[model samples]
Target: MTQQTAPCAVTERVIGIIAEVLDIPPHTITPETRVLRDLETESIDLLEFGVGLNAAFGIPVADDTVFLTSLRVHLEEARHADADPYKMMAGRYPHLSCDRVACILRTLDDGPVLSVQDIADYVLHALRAGQHEKAPSHAG
Candidate 1:
């Protein structure tokens, strides 16, 4: 698939994985669908989802703390600098919507379970950051 279509493919795969793990129909999972609020995803499910993402995309999908901490730090810095939090976050996470960022900010105390769209955005970020690559072959 072309670069333009790669995101869509990744989104579809993410939804498929979520649906399978959650035992929910793929049709019900949208980019805005909340993992914790809507699906009531358990901790184990989140762990499995992270593993699935890492395995599928060849990128690291660590615990939410890393991303959450980074977001909080950015927002705090933006607030201190008298910058618009949404705009600052938009600059960093171009793939996410303003509404999504707002939702994440509002839910900061809740571990930022993240929407399907959020996960897709993270995957895209990883791909753009050059985090995804084939393992080096050791054939001699």
Candidate 2:
């Protein structure tokens, strides 16, 4: 694929992963959809999203806090920008910086291998931690 074509394809696929994970209609999820507003995606969802992205691109971006923070920045920009969200994300996230994104695209472009459910499970675990803290206990 040409350099130009590659990003478009990757963006579409990445958004698809997000949509599928959130159980929302893929068509409704523009790249601009705020994880909080449009999708109501929780933080756990973001973590899971990261995992799916890593699997797809063939890169290890999980431990890279800098890149994860950058991805959040890009996502916020995309949500606020009045332009093509996928394109905006493509420019901000870029192929080189976001290893998780690159890994996701690679996984998609190469061949179907692993499922994203494992990653989703990880996300649930993270979400539960917060919930556990807030829940009232009756251990008397």
Candidate 3:
């Protein structure tokens, strides 16, 4: 029999993976949990999380530095353009909403960090882009 996993289940498993990697109690982690501010996840921790996420979801996660660099480049270009940055991001990154782009911009301008929701959104985007596949099961 084929096992179908719901998206919420996948999100929960992602949260579980984050909790395990960070050695934090699962109850304390939420969608809004900030990897840096809330969990104090450093560069190494993010690297580990990226590996874990790839292993769990069968997705290729670019190294944290590469991901951040690309994001920063986009943000930098938007900042210099006359068009609204959030709108540009929404148009450029169709998977992400304008509000999400705004949040990412705010986080970039105020602090360099990403929330759990942001990571999940990236995963979803990758999935939609045909760059990832849902895990066979949650066992991972």
Candidate 4:
């Protein structure tokens, strides 16, 4: 029998971010480590990490529910089996890669309020923009 891996591959990524942000080596942090008690991470940092992670994975991390440990758990549960996971989420949420979403969300004092529709819109806009950016410029 083969061991089943978590659906989402955010564990290593999360650990990388935590290590970078906290200046704690990856070897030191574990799933059981409490951000506050064990890692001594402040609330602000934790929230910021959520926003950043959201952008990185194109997934929204609700401020109320965004905690380091919780984020890890949630990401681990995300299913990417569909042909278009982002599209599937459109009717509900505009899931952006954690990095992209988080970067945009971080700029807001509160939230980016992402939904699946918003993600579709952003993605469409991004694709259009990219096409235009890549178009060859002509001079008369």
Candidate maximizing lDDT: 1
Per-candidate TM vs. native?
0.67, 0.43, 0.74, 0.42
Per-residue lDDT of model 2, residues 10-57, tens digit only = 556666778877887778765444444445666677677777665554
**lDDT values, one for every candidate:** 0.75, 0.48, 0.68, 0.44
Model 2: lDDT to the true structure = 0.48
Give the per-residue lDDT of model 3 (tens digit) for 32-60.
77767777676777778788878876788
Residue 135 lDDT in model 2?
26
Instruction: Sort all candidates by lDDT, best to worst.
Output: 1, 3, 2, 4
Among these predicted structures, which one has the highest TM-score? Answer: 3
Per-candidate clashes, comma-separated? 0, 7, 0, 21
lDDT of 4: 0.44
Which structure is stronger by TM-score: 1 or 3?
Answer: 3
lDDT string, candidate 4, 83-110, tens digits: 3333333322333455544543354344
Error of 1 at 71 (Å): 5.8
For candidate 4, what is the TM-score? 0.42
Better of 3 and 4 by lDDT: 3
Lowest lDDT 10-residue stretch of candidate 2: 113-122
